[model samples]
Target: MPKVDAETIVHSIAAETNTPEETVARIYADALDTYRADARVLDYVPLFAARKVRATLRQNSAKPH
Candidate 1:
């Protein structure tokens, strides 16, 4: 199987959370920005960012109005 990348993560989470792709992409970019600000390690940055975005989406989904 082909390896998954950040784009794939964003799309997957967007679909799973029933969010717009643009919104998910924006969120992913924001997550990357946060990591970059901290000078996070290079190799695992994408994975970490994806995990962060996924958690954010999950948390948002779980919140009640």
Candidate 2:
């Protein structure tokens, strides 16, 4: 499988979640780094990172502010 591009993932998730690309990019980068820190296999890092970003966005949006 080809390596996933971070920009592409960030853009797609941002659009799909109706979030700013900057926020998504930041969260995605953090999630990617966190996952990469202890990853044994890197193939699914992007997928997992995207999921974490989405879940985080959802949680944030759900919070009372």
**Best candidate, TM-score-wise?**
2
Clashes of each: 0, 0
Off by over 4 Å in 1: 1-4
The regions of model 2 sitting more than 4 angstroms off are none
* Highest-lDDT candidate: 2
lDDT, candidate 2, at 52: 97
* Alpha-carbon lDDT, every model: 0.83, 0.95
Candidate 1 has its poorest 10 consecutive residues by lDDT at 39-48
